[model samples]
Target: MDIDRKKSTYLTLGILFMILLSLIRWGGETLQYLFYLRVPLISGALLFMLPIICIYLLPSMLGNLFVLKNKWRMSLVIPGAVATGLGIVIIGGIIGTNAAARFNVSPCPLLEALLQDDALTPYLFALILAFPTAWAAYWSSGPASKEMSNTDRKIGVAIGSILSLLLMGAIYWARTGETVSWVSDMLLMIISILPSEARAGLVKDDQLTPGLVTASAFLAVSTILYLIGLLLYRPKIKKDRWQLPALSYVLGLLLIFSFLFGLLTFVLDYYRVPVLLSFLAVSALAYKLWKVDHYYDIRPTPTEPPKPDDFIGALKERLAHQQGRRTLVVVCASGGGIQAAGWTSMVLTGLQKRLGKDFTQAIGLISSVSGGSVGTLHFLDRFGNEGAPEDSELNAIFNASTEDSLGATGWGLVYPDLWRFSGLPFLHTQPRDRGAAIETDWKSFMKSPNATLRDWVDPIKQGKLPVPVFNATIVEDGRHYLISPMTFATEPLEGLEFNRLYPQHDMDASTAALLSATFPYVTPITRNSEEDDSQSKVTPVFHVADGGFFDNFGIVSAVDWLNEQVLPKRVELEIERVLLVEIRAFPDEEPLQTASRKNVGFLMSLFGPLLTVLAARNSTQAQRNEDIVNDLKTKWTAKDIDIFDFKISFPKNIPFFEIPTQTGYENIDQYTTALKDEKKAYTPPLSWTLTKKQKDAIRNAWEILNQDQSSSVAELEKVWSRK
Candidate 1:
């Protein structure tokens, strides 16, 4: 074949490849809307193609600007195409991940939300990304061959310019005929996804007119395309060796900076400070403590030491009489949304039955954060309450079907909308009213009818509950605020200082549980304000967000509370043994090291940093916990402190909603039949049964406690006989 003809054939194939890629990207979204939402197929197809054409033309125009010889230019083609495609995927992933995180939903749900809202900003951002992506592809393709005939080059430029104009014209024509105002539609869509309070001020009334704004935007975009086409017509082939390398360096730097900026913004928006800042603050605190050498004295002095007859003091005396044979059981549950909550309920139910009548009395402390608190709070509320059934009833309440747990009414589907509307500061008549709507529905689903906040607090205060249960939440200052019964105790110790932060506030068990269980964007941030007459302004609003943000499992807070408060006060009873029970929802899976060269994999890698941070934090906490346990074990031998970690694995295919429901015996029977009918489907193991897992965990706990108690008692008897 003639060299020119061969080159033309390759160019044509490249354009066809771009179209195929575009079709795959946008076509999937179009089909989803068409089948699921019943969006007009024609409209969906047309809407989908608009972005495709825009993206497809970008690489074509970029490739045409370069005039290169056969082998070198062809080599550039593959690299350019891959770079552009990968760039789009990576950028989309970053956008989608941030959006999902901000909205507190999964990526698929966030995409659906954007589609339903008809949000244009995401599309516009994609369009904006195309320019740099196209440029990167163009640069990789190498400079146009200076040896090419002028005639052939002119012909290529004319073809490209005409095609670009035609494509732009078609997009504009299709957009203009639409009844929906795309600009205002997009603005409203963006506002809808924002938190309720932020939505009102996002756009002004003047910005609501779609026609003028849309026209202006269309004109600006068309002009930019036209200019780029003009540049392609008169190709500038940089022959200077240094120039291309310098340009590549600049482009790479810009891309890296852009990614870093995005990451910083994401961290700051969610955490109210940069991750680095948080890290530095933690380091500084550690340094300050080290410098003090005797930092324990820095803690506030307690109002008074407890007499032997007082609450904790009496408990200490009882344990002393038992000759250190009493087990100090500390249960630490991790957060994993509603699934974790169900697991917690299962574990607690098993513990209750295993302990028999002494279920409430045997528990030393139940420390939890996020979803785990939901079950812990519920259990504490109903444990010894009148008319509350012991085991099966608890399971029924916690492991209820999704319809029953969330709500049978369709209103549950719009629970997110409630979070949006109810978060508005102006709309809320009272501070509690801010989250009241969503909280009411959530509490209805999760709260135990007999569990009052007082039930959890009263027991701890009166020493009926051995040690106060620790429920943690992250306040505005990015610190863990421990909400325990001791928070309200008359102690002036630093451990109880967090309670003073929200003084006079009635923190019912349900409310505290709700606050601790708040899972970022899923639950609205609870804001409380107080007027400061002296300053002539309301004091800085105190925001209570997710406890998981600070400590997902409450292990850190539990250990801190034990070391700082409980141990110091109990002079007669040293923590001879510590049993840490950790309940995890999923089995430990291998980390991703090598990803497939696919768009989904590329997108997933965008969350690598976030996953790393979470993994590191969990690992650090686990190590710290082990260190505490080891210190006790080394001092009193390995029999002193034992950590019982339980990881309950459910079938990966089981939907999160179904996991909780499947825990109940009736639900299990129904699911089992369903699984049989679909033989290829994953059948959940019998161990996945919530009650069974709970029983297993409790039985394990008992064995550990009994073994330690037996050994300690035997040692005590030996000493007594010798004396």
Candidate 2:
């Protein structure tokens, strides 16, 4: 049974036992108190709470009746027999008073007159008290006698009987004034303190019992033994030790008794001595066991080597055969910046294949540096919660999932358009759509086969390059390397404003070299709002402090130069030239003409879903949101640091000078008419417009030129012309 059930059962049993004891004592004491002057029932109940009364005497009554099986041995039985004889003496004394004249004997002043006589002196008085009280201690030992073995029980009873008879004989002698002694008085005092004296009502008479000395001695010796036994009876899982069952019962009874009566336990405590001592001893043993085994290696088989795969093909086969409900692809970069893009492509493809086309699944792209712009979108798509990346669960998922040490590769695919194009910091093409960019970058890397450049450029290549790409922006401000794209975008202007910035204002030779070297792969494609309808085609290229593309459009050499020279000197250049720039440009200065490539509004919207998917890759909803926000902000803010918000606008034939100027004198209609006239004047001839075939050839030539040395541009031109 559980502890509750056991406690309930015990509680019921205890209540019943208390009731039974109360009833028996109530009847006996109520009747006695009616005949006597005191309320015996209440007094007996109070006395029962005492150690001598309850702990010892109650059991003695039962032993006397059942175990001893002798009615004559009861103190009440012998006392009743002698009471009739005492009455005869009292009657004779009264008769003597009545017949004082006839018998010539006055009543002995009731019994007091006779007791005052020299014949009934102090010594005799003490003897008289000792005689009846000696039986109290003798009977008190009777209950314990019953618990002994058969042999001990018989001997104890015989000894008890002899002591009882001897005490009774002494009482008879005292009644006749025969046993008068100091020793008897001392013995009487000893007996009165015993449980039997309290049981028999002798102690209540104010009589000094001689058994007090012996009882006190027994109590002292038992207390010492109790302490010692407690010390010895420790809990060990062995035959010689105290068992849990017996100990529980003993402790339980003590607990109940303490609750019922305020059994105050202090320094000289009688309870819990054994339990505490045993607990201490057991604790010591446990400590020793722990010390001995602390360093022991209980674990089996010290080491197990992993089985080596014999054939790579077989391993692949086995891997393919294993059935999994879900598959996870991990990505890792230097700081996990490029990993986001890789994850985006994988997730999109996986979802498309698994769910089919036009599936209404939302994709997210997140950056490690930025918070949860991406993941938040994903959450809205999935669970529809709108908490920011930092405080949201999405952020945690993104951070927790980006473990770079796990052999996951980052997606840093730099496409040709990214390298050749100018303006926006870092490669920005979506991996799924950068076909021309990827093909050109791949050819360049293949043709060059330069390890140093390959390692550096591969990460920036927004193609099928198996390297991680980071979101690095050399904004006009040039200060701290703010890793988060989102924070950089949304972050308040710390040092400089946009209008004061200039890209080529004070360009130095080394700075020029760095810019020239990195311009190819890090170019930002200009997209004129009127000329380009396919706005989605434009991608971001990597830039550096030298105000040039690391890989303009798709030129690997430019990316190599930025990575090798410009990036290494990025910090130095930023410190000296940036200080000069900041000193030169003020927030109020003419806003440096920003390139028109701010088409990020539409591009951002277009790739927003893709970015969200990228963020969600290898992360939960919460993480995806965080990554997207962070990446977006970082890329956006990079404009200030790199200072090259070069707009990717479509090429236009009309020059800035050719456009009509608006003056206060010109009304709205007049200005409109002038612009229309200029437009008509500048209209291109139909013959000059390139054919579809020509455009394709030019595009193909651009791709071939972007390659290093392997693919010939001439060959590409020939094919394009023939097609």
Candidate 3:
């Protein structure tokens, strides 16, 4: 792809991905209160409306004010926006359900909170009419109506004026209605986390003061200050006129508001804020210019060059095929987020380090899923040139893999990205979707600029870079979606051929890496469609979810290649021995006794089957992979060919120590004390980013290698030594 096309694809995907994320955010909150929690019908409707207006409508409206070149075109979009807003509840509920299962969260609080008199009932009818009425009134007079005739605009202005007065009257009627408690709690929480010196009047006699001077220092809201900030935003007027942009004050305030919201949703679990907070006028105008314009969408139309190739076409030039008699290797990488990423990279690095030229020369392809794909992508990034040792640049790549993504993504979800959805702040901001944020951050965090996906095409075909196949799942059709240097062997495999389906687009290298890893609701599901296909708007948009949903261990596709491609056509291609390597994040499965559910409630009855399915989604696919491996070994063992399976499991010994003890506590007091004293086990976090401590824990993984891992490495070494 030319430079312009690449940028366009990135911008388009990035922006749309951002928009999808905000929708997800709205859906998540909306679904939580109205559907999942199943609050009273009236109360639920009250809870659901603001997320649509504030999160979905407000930002888009403000954004359109500057972006919509044809102000008349926006009228067409309004109906879509309103329809989309209403449709969000159902679509959002599906996302919520999937996410709830993945994260194992239950958002409903005690009945008292939902049923409280002060919660929502008194202001119910007024809010029901007021919010939407205000929305309509604003739209008629606001940016969307700018192209209207003077007479129409004046009439709109009149209606808006009357509605604005009525809204003030309504506000007076509901004076400080849970607004103070909600606002005070938010302030106190944010202030408490700040340094004492930064939080003046935050506490007196060990009690928090909920006044303007306390709770949050960032709350300096003023239209005049904001305008002054923007007026002085010019960098060219005096490049060093000031170290800090005057805009920082406004941004600081906006950021505080978002951070507090995140605190409520994820950390505090405090959702007692009387349904919705009225829109803040300052917020609507604050980030209007903070848009991710598509040139970088400079018409940022990111796309890929067409170097699409088929599976056989890709394999023709590999040294292993040319050699005719040497053993060929295909590796299967498992899915376990970054933990799996670290482990997969380590295993590959060890192979290259230990086996040297033999390993690099013998390897044919790496079939990877989720985090495995991420790791494999990293390895392949620097492996484009054979002049460099295969593992030469791996240290940097490995460190890049460990850099923090979840931190930025956590905030990205609520704040900066939510405001504009498709476009970043003109300054170039991170995306809010977990997949986009991680992929975006991951790419930026790379020590050096990444070579694009197509950059490796020629080198791969010429037998320089090894081919790595990452898989995602088709939501409509449960098939493996391949993201690889060469497209899949579609004749043999029952899956989606990505390059074939979308020939014109080039996914960002970061996006390609994480496409397989965006498990559950961590990121927006990919929707593939053409820009001009208006019919696609109504059709069920094609969805591509995390590859792990179909095959957490990437062996299924690897085995399919052996079964349908390699074995059937061995004579046409140079026949050789096959060595299949399975690298897993988990230890071998052990049978265990099942626990009985003592009680079953209404929610349980509804979701029990759904929960069972979610829990089994990975394991079932994993077991199928194992079965496929075993079947291949059995079926091909006596075939007129050679085959072997090597297993490298992540060390069972993580960072922490464990011991089996026979002794038991004698009494209730002793048992309770023992439980309290017990340390939290060192389970690897399932996040896109890992901290230094987490990395440290994984650093010694190979050192504390389990028997299976040690044996596999030793055996591979022995085999290579003889070869």
lDDT of all predictions, in order shown? 0.42, 0.26, 0.52
Could you tell me the TM-score of candidate 1? 0.46
Best by TM-score: 3
Decoy 2 TM-score against native: 0.14
Number of the candidate with higher lDDT, 1 or 2: 1
In terms of lDDT, model 3 sits at: 0.52
List candidate 3 stretches off by more than 4 Å. Answer: 1-218, 221-316, 320-324, 387-390, 420-434, 445-450, 491-493, 534-541, 596-607, 656-682, 706-710
The TM-score between candidate 3 and the true structure equals 0.57
Kindly indicate the candidate among 2 and 3 with the higher lDDT. 3
Error in Å for residue 29 of model 2: 7.4
Per-residue alpha-carbon lDDT of model 1 for 328-365, expressed as tens digits? 55677767655556656665565455444343344466
Best by lDDT: 3
Expressed as tens digits, the lDDT of each residue in 358-423 for candidate 2 is 121111112111111111112221211111111233322322222111000001112212222222
Looking at model 2, how many pairs of residues clash?
Answer: 114
Q: Which of the two, 2 or 3, has more TM-score?
A: 3
